[model samples]
Target: MKVQQLQNAVEAFDFDINSDEHIPELGRLIADKQVVFVKQKLTEERHYDILDSWGSPGMSPVIAGIGLGKLKGLHWNAVRNTTARIGKLIDPRHRSRMQSVTFQKDHKGRALGIFTNGKLGWHSDQPSFESAQRVVGLASVEASEGSQTTFLSTAECYDNLNCEDRSQVDELMCVNRWDMISKNVFDHFAGELIEEQHAIMRYNGCPLDGLTAPLKGQTASGVPGIHFPGSLFGYFLGMSVDESKKYIKHIWSLMDKPEYIYTHNWKDGEVCYMDQAITLHARPTSVDEGDMRRMWRCSGYLDKLYPGQGPMTMKINVEGEEITWDELFKRVDEVRKAEYNRTKWSKIFHKMP
Candidate 1:
């Protein structure tokens, strides 16, 4: 494949994207370049097949276990079937698209995708999870005219930090939760969310609730970078939400510099893959409702780099204490059950009145 640089990202030209021979090179390009774009027409099935070559598609079983149900002790086929059904029940349109990426609504007005006409905030895909997807791929199903997706290389940002800043970032932990409207990312710059956007926020926030991870993440090659979840960020581990905002914004400033950023204008029959572990991407431009901007998006680990490492676990920082993922999952479960009970009771009381 012929390659050329596109600002901070790289663009590949003239290659068989679907060939197994090119898959390794494609994976390496995404890792080294952080973002690699290619103009190639791909079907919905082809888009998903390319991602499957990288690793397991859709949500990592580790995160899915918390939302869908425990995936332990299930056969591989059974697990896939179970998750597919449960995932569909959670969001029907998303399930139809392989539960990989969001899309726009159809003529029937049924929410076909979570991504509507709005400017998305800067962040990696699903950074709230301990085992967040390592790579993200987006294909232009319908060219996103009049909109651009900007990407920033956090790995480069981390490398440029001074000794003190680097040390600080390494030791820091940040809390991420999606259940709260206050943490809604789409509203980062925009005003109040419309009902559809609010629903999207809830789904995005539910999978990895009240979890903490190091502010720094590493590429599979061991290059360190910022693990920013954008507006989904709740707070730092030891700092109050108000206190954490100062630091979060400060760090965000460093990454947003032009030297580390690239903005891509989409075209029909174009596909791009980005290293989610080492990059933050944004949609700074707004899309009108009538625009035919749609993409087939996928995020997962690259099998060549992260093989057979499903159902991964990590140590989570809570307050000043460190806890196992299992403990955190249990705590989240209890809180969810309690919240469900309160809502249930409130509904019953309203009927009585």
Candidate 2:
């Protein structure tokens, strides 16, 4: 296996990803470099295998469990069987959200994947919530031409800051909300707020008010870096509305530097892993030939990292009360169950095999 440096990423060529001996080295590369690309073909099951080796599978509620049916307005058990009917359920791990980003639709004209045709803004998955994934991996499946996934490492951006800006960033707090996130991050994109998307978020238990620290741990390395969720940003904590706007502009100007950015034009069968704590990514263009392109995505914490060093450890507040990450998810699960029973889709779908 050989490795080379891209502008702000590390590319591993001829690497034996399936070999157990190489897993530790690959884990190190992902931790230190924050972004690593391996040019190799991977099936959906294999994609989950690599991520699972690192830690727990970071399942997005919207894409997993009860939220899956809720998001599509279908019955949960029905969707599960529909997924299985299309193909055999090869493994139990497949039950976790191994999201496919595609425009293709099923026979009933339902989209086969999420974010089928849109320009995704600068953001991290689950940015507003404290339960952000530690690492995210994407495997290119088919026809990924004319599209690019761009990434920016806040760790690099933080290192570039002057002492004054760095100090201010450390002391500052950021407020993130689902309601105003689209307007702040995707001002240029049409239809900023998709109501169905927000409804799914609510069903999955994402809070409206998410309090975050501007500077937090970047990776398992435990180095401090800016946690800049530009998309989900509502305002800085304890700042006036007007003052927050001005301050955000100033902060973004510093973090969104050209030197810290890397844009990848994907090739088929390639996989990219990103350390979520330190980085922000975006799909810079809308899918014109959406049916032709597909990618598999999974995110979760890395096992190689020290315990308590993951995103779940971040100090975050919901509403006004501070709670443990597990506690938050438990509460959300309860709400999801209530909605599932209330909707009666549970009965319809679960009644099937």
Candidate 3:
């Protein structure tokens, strides 16, 4: 195995994924570098194996059905055309589970065929959940030109903050609400919210009430950093929403410093792994419809480092009996089919203004 620094804080390695030492060595590298980039083409089985070695495989409520014929994990089919339509037409409750990021356009040069809006705001993955993801891995199957992913280390950002600022933020907790942050995006695509379908679209049993998480959390190696993700909807628990926005914006200014940021231009066969809990990432809106940008993404938790916080567990009332996570999914799948069958054409056409 050969390892080298891709940037000041990101490392790139040429190592055998099947080797016995791969997991420990990669874990150490992830500790030292907030993100690690490796150049290798991994098969689906190998991909899941690497993710499983890190922690329990995370299941996205949105992509649960996508993995029907595949393995039993959160598998996202993030093709450009499919994701674009799903983002707009799918119910918000279900849309949240569709967490793949893509920027694809059609031959007409219009933005109608992409899932996430261009230039996704800087954010860590799933901060609204009680147990935010710790590690995220993305492998490029097809690379897009003029597209880059930018990352900022929250640990580094926190270190750069003045002592007084750090002290104030350290004492606070932030409320993360998926609905508030995503409201405009969803509204832009899906029009007004569908009140009746709201309850069915939840992901991993996370409540719509939102999560109250500490502003600072420790990495696996005990490095402390800001844990809040970049979303318009969060607020410092005791502060007014406006006050929280001002404070978060101040932090964003600090993080925007060039020294704390790294940009990676995607190359096919490259796999990038990030410690999502301590890092924020964003992508520019550069892909046109003809651009071929496809990536396979997998994320997992590091329970030992940030334990008792994630792998959200919830009990669902199923015919008067509480069911487990697996059982609940089965019930959800059945309901999803019924709903789709009932409103297939209307849901698709209703998104058109």
The residue-by-residue lDDT of candidate 2 on 1-353, one tens digit each, is 67898988889877677676676677767778888999888778777877777776665543454443433434345445444432222245564646676766667655556556667777666666555677888888888877799988777778878888888787776777656655534454323323333443332223434645454546766655777756556677778757887877887887787878899998898999997767878888677543588888777777544566443455447644677655655554555556677768767888889
Lowest-lDDT window of 10 residues in candidate 3?
70-79
Cα error of candidate 2 at position 166, Å:
0.9
How displaced is residue 97 in candidate 1, in Å? Answer: 8.1
Candidate 1's C-alpha runs over 4 A off are 58-63, 66-68, 71-108, 178-186, 189-209, 240-243, 308-313, 320-329, 351-353
lDDT of each: 0.66, 0.66, 0.57
Q: Predictions ranked by TM-score, top down?
A: 1, 2, 3
Q: lDDT by residue for model 1 over 1-353, one digit each (tens)?
A: 89998889899887887676777778777767788998888876677767777675545434455345542322223324433433442234334325423344445554444455567677676566545667878887765665689998887789889999889788887777664436344476323333544433443343446666678887655667888767667788778888888888888888878989998887778888888776888778776565657676666777545664332545555544677757755665565556667877899999995
Which 10 residues in a row give candidate 2 its minimum summed lDDT? 189-198
RMSD (CA, Å), each prediction: 5.1, 5.9, 8.5
lDDT of 3 by residue, 1-353 (tens): 56776553566556677675766668656655777888777754565567666665555533443544321322222222343343542234323222333444345543322232335556676554434566777767665445788777777778777988899768876665545656664343222323322232234222333446667766666677887645534577778989988988887687687787778887777778887667877665444444567665667765543455346543433222444546545554554555455676677789889
Tell me the RMSD of model 1 versus the true structure. Answer: 5.1
